[model samples]
Target chain A: MKDKKPMKSVFKAGAITSEFIGNSIYKHQTKTSIGAHNIFLGQVRADDIKGKTVSAIEYTAYEDMANQKFHEVRESAFEKFDLTCMHIYHSLGTVKAGEICLFVFVSSPRRKVVFEALEFIVEAIKADVPVFGKEIFEDESHQWKLNS
Target chain B: MLITIKYFGQIAEVTQKEEEQLEVSKGSVSGLLNTLNTKYSDLKNKDFQIAQNQELVDLDTELTGAEIALLPPFAGG
Candidate 1:
C-alpha cells in the first residue's frame, strides 16, 4: 500500500503556489517581448550573530491579507511600470538560512525599465507586504528582521 | 470567552508561548490591548504591535466582532 501525504494544503503552500503562478503568468505574457529579462532571487543569508550560525528562517504571514496585498502590488506594477511582465514569490515556511526565499523576475521591451521595475517591485514588497520572518540561530535563539 | 492570542518572534519569547487567548469583553482594539498588557507585564517593554483581520492596525481601531491578530514591528525580506 502506498502512503498518502496530507491531502489538505496549508497556508504555507498557498504562498508558494501563488508565487509559481506569478512566474508562469509572467512567462506567458512576455513570450513575445524582445528585450532583456532581469531576475533577482533573494536568498536567506546566514548571518553570524555572536558566533552562532543562522540555521533557518521561518516565515509567517497573514495569508489572506498577503494575497490581497500581492494582487494589489501586481496591479500597480502593471499600471505604473512599462514592462512586458513581472513576478514576485516569497516562501511561507522554514527556509534554510542560506536558501532562496524570495524571487523577483521582470521582463520588458527595454532593459532600462526592467532594471527600474525590479528595484521598485522589490522595495514595494519589502515595505508594503505583511510577511514576517524569524531567524533561528544554530542554538535555537531567534530574532525577527524588519524588512529593511 | 478566551480568545487565543498568538505571539511571534520577540513577542512569543516574552510571552513564552505561541498563543494565549485571554478572556475579555468584546471591546475596542485598545481596550483589549490594555487588558492584555495589564495581565502580561512582559509585553509592556517590548516594542510590539497589533493586527486585526490579518492586517496591521492602530490602537484606536474597533474590534467588536472581528478576528484580531497581533504582530510585532514586521520582520520580513
Candidate 2:
C-alpha cells in the first residue's frame, strides 16, 4: 500500500529565524516516541565572485511542482526508513548571508535511522526540488545559482 | 490551442514576465520551444527545463495544452 501523507506548505517568506527553529524543537518534546531527531539547516553563504561579495539570496520556486516534489520525497523517506515524522521549510524571498534558508527535520526511534534518513532527504531536496536562488552581489548585481 | 506558460527565476528574468498566454500549433515540446525562441531572442541563450502539467518533460514529448513552465537550474538546499 502507498503511504498517504498529507501535503504541507514548505515555503516561508524571508529568512527562517533561529527562534522558530528552537520552538519547533521544543514542541517535539511532547512526542515521547521520538528518541532521535536530526536537523539540517542550510545557510546563505556570502560567496565572493571576482571582486564582488554576495550579500543575500533571493529564492523563488514553481510552487505547485515544488510542493508535489516535497511530498514525494517525504513519502520515499518514510518507505525507506522508520521515521516518526519529517518537516521541511524553505525561504521564499530575500535571505541575508549567514541566515537560514532551508530547514529539514527528521525524527526516528533510533539514532542510526535519523542519520541515514537526514542525508537522504537533504540530498533528494537539493537534486529534485524546483527552487531557484538568485545570488545578489554587494554591488546590487545578481546571478543565478545552480546546484553543484 | 491557447497555452498558459509560466516562467520562474532567471527564466522569468529573461522573459521579463512571470506568465503569459500563447497560441501554439499542434506540436512537440521542441516545436513549442522553437516558437518561444523566435518570440524571445534572449531565451535561446538561457538554460532551462520544460515542465508540462507540472512534470518535467523531455524535448520530444508532445504538447498537451497543459500548464507549461520554464524552469531554470534549481539552487534550493
Q: Report the lDDT tens digits of candidate 1 across residue range B5-65.
A: 6676677777777776677786678888888788778888887667676667788877755
Error of 1 at B1 (Å): 9.4
Candidate 1: segments with Cα more than 4 A from true spot = A1-30, B1-6, B14-27
Across residues A14-125, which tens digit of lDDT does each residue of candidate 1 receive? 2243456455656565376547777776778888887888888888876666666776677777777777766666787788866667777777778888888888888878
Q: What is the lDDT of residue A89 in candidate 2?
A: 97
Name the candidate that leads on TM-score: 2
lDDT of 2 by residue, B1-77 (tens): 99999999988988899999999999899999999998889999999999999999999999999999999989998
Sort candidate 1 into its docking category. medium
- Candidate 1 achieves a global lDDT of 0.69
Q: Can you write out model 2's per-residue Cα lDDT over A7-122, one digit (the tens) per residue? A: 98899999999999999999989888889999999999999999899999999999999999999999999999999888899999999999999999999878999999999999
DockQ of 1: 0.55
